[model samples]
Target: MILNDFLPVNKADLLKLEWDYLDFILVSGDAYVDHPSFGPVVIARVLLDAGYRVGIIAQPDWNDPNSIDILGEPRLGFLVSAGNMDSMVNHYYVSRRHRETDNYSEGGAMGKRPDRATLVYTNLIRKKYKDKPIILGGIEASLRRFAHYDYWDDSVRRSILFDSAADLLIYGMGENQVVEIAEYLNNGIEVQYIQHIPGTCYLTKSLENLDQYIEIPSFESVKNDKIQYAQAFKVQYDEQDPIRGKTIVQRHSETYLVQNPPTMPLERARLDWVFKLGYMRNYHPMYEAGGGIPAIKEVKMGIISERGCFGNCSFCALAFHQGRIITSRSHESIIEEAKMIQMDVDYKGYINDVGGPTANFRHPACKKQLKVGTCKHRQCLHPEPCEHLDTDHSDYVELLKKLRHLEGIKKVFIRSGIRYDYLMHDQEDAFFYDLCQYHVSGQLKVAPEHIDETVLDYMGKPSGKLYGQFVKKFDQINKELQKEQYIIPYLMSSHPGSTIHSAIKLAEYLRDINYTPEQVQDFYPTPGTMSTCMYYTEIDPRTMKPVFVPKSNKEKAMQRALLQYKNPRNYDLVYEALILAGRQDLIGFHVKALIKPRTNVPKAGGSKKSKSSKRKTPSSKTSINSIEKTKKRR
Candidate 1:
């Protein structure tokens, strides 16, 4: 239980370790928490286990030049990252307003790190030590390796390596890539010669020997034309697999940006070894007086049983970052971690979660994924399950059963999102029944995203009819078990293809179900997602088809208000949206009406209105059959 067992973060710690020089100095935007959930910690631990000396510098002052000099220079090079999240997304909201809290910081404080953190940190290091090699890895660097649209600046920018002046950019999960790069560097190989490694991006004077690689549109073309940008993103999206993926190259003004194929997925033993490292499982003791790090609470008791995802939602970045191949830990590895949790002094007989990107996904999508990789043009679960998809849940079910029966463990909940579409694909009912009986804590959260068929199609999700069938099956199982469990759905507003009419349709559906969501999430256009491309260019990247995007603040607000029309504050916006959508007939006082008409009341000096002031309404039927079908859930 020694607190000093964590990575060296200061000069004193380096002195204690008796190391005169280190191989790599890792810089991160988040406060150092030596848990597997944090990206910097995982990469640092992997490098450390490879017999290389590593030190860390977290959240250094960007205004002062001497802030990054605490840890002297490393022997080989420096590793730079912007922590678990992208710096811009961590600092600002969709409205371009600064956020009040930073979840990855101590005490939930803000202003810890600067914007474009990878660029800032790399430049800072370059200012002090101009000749040293600097390598960038993490979400901020991986997604920005190509010329991407900058939401904050409202313009397309060149590759981050050009701005940051870093030697190499390691994309995706960089366990194998980092080790290979380190081994090459340690053996006296220069950074210029390290471009041939897989999962690394670098700038070249020409595409001389890369005729076999797939050439994308140049940066200048995409920066000027929105249609070309969509085409470029489509080419990038289709070639992310490790097996059949080809090396991709894009041209800038004078240089070419070459991105090698993704690194191979981790095998069972390698995945287990990475998680079994000596993680402190909490924030460093120096931050204990500041109430510790808030981000650690999310995974302190939760076990990441797997990695990668096959459910490629259009709005999610997992496909680009973690890839669409699923890799998991052995059951013995998971049980060993759970046993460690049972020994905690604060153990309350509860395990928060036992899943990764998607909880139920334990292995690759199918047998062919191991050899040929995932399909380049189609997704495994989107639109419909592939004919070759292996949808067995037996391994997950057996693992959960063993965890719940442990001596000191009490309730085990699956808080991570479960893919209901995949669950329904399974022919057996054992996993579904056991999930309802054991894993649920009164409510199970799922994401159907939207009910409109057009919007669902744009979202890369199944139709609403599939969700209806799943809901019916869930209710039937709960009834048989005599439990009062509920399924709370996560819905989104103002996604691509969702027009004013579509918003009104969602509002009417909510009214019929007699349910209201407390909060609604507006679709955020983060980098490296198919949906974000549509949001910025008004065209789908996959098919280059025109899409309806809600970009104005007023339009986005009105769409969000329609989801929560029951709130008195949203009455005006909802009323206006209904009128604009040609649904003014739903303004009267009736069971099918969405809102009441705006009427003037008597002021201090005015007279009261008569009963005739209320508008007369006629009985109407609004999707009564759909309402009856959904009555069991209520």
Candidate 2:
């Protein structure tokens, strides 16, 4: 049975009943959204498919101990995870600025700290069942696998494995590693035995046994003495000695046991858990709270037909977490899900997103090239596009056509943002025409982060010319179809390579297109992500060196405010921004003239004292009038 099967029971009452029943209960700190995060949901589904009973606790309040009992009870099984999406309240919205420094966004520190939350959650479980396994995954646990700087606390913290009291901390992708852990536990293998498992971290009372093994130095040690770790890690995976993997020694009490490359899961196996619909509950609950229609409540809904894309945009984390290789679902499974959504009464008449990462890019381009063992290119986003890489639109066209003919489905839409550059590669332009004539709800979203070629190059995005070409083609199609649909472009500002000059160029592009977009985003750096590290430290983790750093606050605010040029308040910000950019020549021009210049005049001392503070002198006439009134009363 799936997790939603227990919804009929009262959550408070359910907490009071069972103390020790569930084989494994997974708790998530993040609101269980269908976004790639429901990794625990995926992991739980996989375990259930393997014939083990599993349950999930989504968005449990760590501050409330009662929420822990909702999982029923912990038993002899594994607790898997990726940590909470937001470590604290401040992390959720970038709009909130720090009190002291009008510059930095407030660091995430409002909710219960992860280690403390885990401690409280684990103690509740231990009271019911002693020594059950608890393991942590996700970006938080993975990046914090070793000692690292804590910007919130302003100090280095201990390893999360030691702090959270988890049996093990799985680092990278957990598909293969999680199963290995479960099988070992089922055979009555002690948690200690799995310490050597690759892509995982475990704790022991002493480091005696691991001394013989290859040691990977902590990030702190590398930061203090870069020469040692850089040289060690620079050795290519193949060139390194077999016995001694790329192990960097640093001067610290802790060390890392660097493993070889990670193991990837099969496409078929990953898709199996997805069709079971474990994440449906997670996604629905949030939409209900937010006063929006959940996917299940809608007339029609669909899951991604695939995982991962090879676009490798610098600002995207999907490529990092999901990997560059494309993993697709069988065509039959996707059609079946569409049919199921159509059957639901809530189905309004729309089929939501039916595609994955880069919706239209279907098959892996590198599969054939890799088989020949002659692949020389590291990335497909380079200047010279791969000749073998098939930028084909046939598969997407076929999928959309098939989806449109499904029973009882009225409108099939492509809601997920599409890569316009890739869409431009449609050989016959049939898909573009079909999309304009049939799909889309009057607007198609596309991401063109900036118009500057240099910034575009650094971001690994298509040239500005590519977006323009797609727009022109799309416009022609719309005119032919007599449709009033427009393009809703998604733009990112203050990315690592973007500067004030680049932002101005983007603003000019927006103005030229006569597009006033409300959907503008400032880049957010999440843990373990390449962009996040580059944003914070200005150092690339792969290279262990510095890169071009941009002034985050001023540049970010300017970018975000560009979409609101017509607003009067934006004029104040725009003027101040121009002054900061040293482009004072542009000040008091255009809309900026409406904003009054700031004044620094001091307040008068007389006005500072209020009227009530100055006592009034009572006249003799007032005293006589008071006496007469007293006499009349007597």
Candidate 3:
């Protein structure tokens, strides 16, 4: 028999395929939700733009190998970035709910975005083409480049490279680094030499190279111990150094690896691999199966009119992550995307959302110092509008009118959530009139986190009156047009500046307006964000000072429960909140009649696994005997 007869059937076929016929395929596991991500699409776009033949495998089932055949098998090494979005965060409700339970280590975790799909694809690639390279990137691979303190699991885990068996791990934005890898391989370089590329973390066989690697020093405190991990995790950026480097676990015991200060922002590329033409497939399953909101129902397929945001809500990370400079897509591209959506078999006469982080805030309201050669680091509203700033809404007005005229599109909706503060401007008022008349289907979501000035200030909101005036104007416009859409204002509770008193005021406002919001968001601190850093570190890295932190759990829970006070069971929470806030007058209301003993145990952490120290997850004892025992204890 020939030597080929010794090989497995599938492997024998792959071994005989000509390398010249192979296409450079980049598969993204990220859900194509129109947001920039750290998945395969970003890299795929780059390779495609560079003239390399590339195809994407989005949200593929990693468990199934047949999915790999969609790209037609002529394959270069696989680009296996897990997902563009964090898998854990996707499973969360509003992000503030708890995640762990005694039966499982990390329940409620929206684990593995398109990345799991990528991992599966990569494994299949290896199964066929034995020596082919498989690279992993994105948040899951990046943050856990080394041993990390997983709070929910309450243990230190091995690197994802070890777990996924990927040949390489491209940690940060895999832009320049990925390009270098492609070029190196094309030029006949081995994978070993390509590991030298910066912005990546990989394993080496020699221990001698350990000292040359970055060190975290503090990582030893938390390994094998969850509480120490939580404490160590709480440490903030060392302001003494300008770089703001990340702390990592070292290769050896009792040592930590601290990376150099964070690198400068990667210049925005013409196309990002994280976002592709059709990446939404990645999120379809989880979102369909998700709690409360469904992506199928929420997203109706529309083009993004703009990129980035300007609203600097302190609690929000959009401004920092996406940037404050607003970039509207050329009207031609948007119209083309709209035309494509009309051709979809699933077209439901409604275009889901068609705006950036904030729909109508189309242009940069303020002229930033970055545009000019010099820097004038001052607020736009501080004194008067600066010389370079043009606070105008004329362009957006024209664009809206043009879109309305498009044919075959049943209804165009603006549901990205609007910044009411910006909408209250002079030119913007007329625009709002048109928006209320045409854009809004029935409900317009506006975030008014809290009524208290202090809380609003903390959230970087303009004013309570701004929202009130907009609502009144919206109503007036609806009356004139003889339509029936209403503003659905989003409210948040237990934010940083919130108190029991402020919560009562918010509840009272809801009562007065007779507006019980369909959703109430509670503040959650995510890792590597400014708000989380503030909450955990208690010091502003910019100012080098401490900030106030309300350390009362009772106060926090009461504030959160106040918004849901209509239920008789919530009376205990609402009554206590009012009394704590020194508004005892509210105690005599229907809130007093529903006082009952608390049955549910208080849950902590988030739907995402907490990278904290070992903490026992609460057991859900539903058995009748267990219930009776629990009831007796209560």
Candidate 4:
């Protein structure tokens, strides 16, 4: 595919196609990369396949209105997105420091897109064409369709609809919503009258009585009180199902934000058609001068066989953004994509990844999920796997088996993530045995998050015992297969429920395992997540119970340092944290001690305590058992 083959970005390309005006113009924060992994490209291609003239304006200059005028106005409307990721998250780190590089931008440079790209771009477009129908989609808009807690501002903000002033907001996977909105506009219907489309949110002046709709707390109430915000979030969370979900309404002063029920998840055939949309599968040549996008490298050969996740970790936004209902393509569809991947000029024997949010999740959690939608208040795999939960991985196992045997494919690895708790629930171990025997490339990565049960409870994760059982089972299976694969468990520090004591306990657990993680994730409170709500409101929305949150930088640093207590640089923080937690016994020169006693003289006003005469030898089993007992008691 040449440059002209791509959707026109400027007047010259439009002239080549002999089109005076486009049906729709897409404005994205990311550089144009016509790949399925990129949301903007997928929406554009879907529109184009529907026989609409779609043009793109990627990373337009927010500083100048003329930059948005390059594509002029579309006959249908404007589709605005903050690229594949939330703009604030893409541009800044948890520490509120500007990121040095943006993988979404050309050459991995910074500042190609502005902060709050959707809001900024929409305002710019409105400045030029005041009456054009502007629609917001992508992660930023999808997750913030309701009133949300904005980490950058440290305050609760109103819905994106009020702020962006866009006619409609398409949340979740927008393939279904975008098409419906386009067709409505194409039929000469005004954007204001197209409010009833599923998966789309629109502003309204009056509340209409609809039996199928539920009303959440008004924005004024949430803004004035955090408790109201949490309550509102719970109501919104309960109505996300496509099969049985109801339209949600929340008042913002005189106007209202009415979110229609989510669009039904695409079936196998529709999903296959979307993936086979003849994507160029590469960055546009326009980026050749600035070096092609680096983000493309990670996903160029990866296959997203499924969409959505049922492993709804509280910290994750997938449930709210992608919905909990899992939808997957057929094996034939995936195999065909993999065959195309093999023919790529840069194709290697290895396929990067073969999964979605949760790689092993091929279908809904259970048979009932398809009929009744997901259980609103209950979870499928947390606490313990529900009896109705489906744990079969035969389909996934067969899919992987076929991929590995495909010509020119040496190894097909599952790099996305595996829900260990879900994997452990499988009674028959065919998938487990196969994963250990074939799929694992030496180490299988998993997210245990933390070792403390109290912290795990607040995280909506299973108990530490489940993770322990999984670790033992993984080792047992590996041993049975005569394989030497290791488990690289992902750990998080300074999460909402984590205190100094919890951090110290986690550190001690790491000491017993004789492993210090090279990387530790400091809890990031992004918008539209239960964890973020807790970080802001200091209350669990599900139970409305107060939660202990680690908010201070010093406290957070201590927790993060404890995860890497083995490092010499972290010795002081580790010792300080231990003392603060009343675990100073873990600071002496002994096998059980997390850190050795300071040899240097004490600083001013600092007192030293005498060392214990008797010290018990460190035993991994004893330490692990003690932690487990503590969890049980809690």
The TM-score of candidate 1 is 0.94
Q: Score every model by TM-score.
A: 0.94, 0.75, 0.66, 0.94
Better of 1 and 2 by TM-score: 1
Q: What is the lDDT of residue 442 in candidate 4?
A: 98
Candidate 4 lDDT, 1-634, residue by residue in tens:
1222688999999899899999999999999998999999999999998888999999999998899989877999999999999999999989899999999999999999999999999999999999999999999999999988899999888999899989999999999889988998999999999978889999988775455678888988988898999998888887889988888999899988999999888888999898988888899999999899999999998999999888889999999888898999999999999998988999978898899999999988999988889998788887778889999999999999999999889988888999988888888899888888877899999999998998998888878888899999999988887889999989999888887789988998999989989999999999888899899898889899887777867678778999999899887667666765568799888898999876565556767533432332323343334334434445
Tens digit of per-residue lDDT, candidate 3, span 284-380: 2323443322332344475566655556566665533344555566666666667766776778766777787788766665554234311223333
Residues 348-376 of candidate 2: C-alpha lDDT, one tens digit per residue: 77787777767776767556632432232
Worst 10 residues of 1 by lDDT: 618-627
Q: Lowest-scoring 10 consecutive residues by lDDT in candidate 3?
A: 1-10
Each model's lDDT: 0.88, 0.57, 0.54, 0.88
How many clashing residue pairs appear in each of the predictions shown? 0, 6, 25, 0
RMSD of candidates 1 onward, in order = 5.6, 13.7, 11.4, 5.2
Tens-place lDDT digits, model 1, residues 1-634: 1223888988898789887888899999999998989998899999998988899999999998998899888999999999999999999988788999998998889988999999999999999999899999999999898888887888889999899999999999999999999999999999988888888999999877775898888999999999999999998889989998899999998899999998887888999998887887778888899978899888889999988898888998888888988899999999999998887776799999999999999988899998998899888987999989999999999999999998888989999989999999999988999999999999999998889988998899887899989999999999999999998989999898887677888888889888799878889888888898888888998888788777767777888999999999988778767765558888989999988887756546667664534533322232222223223322
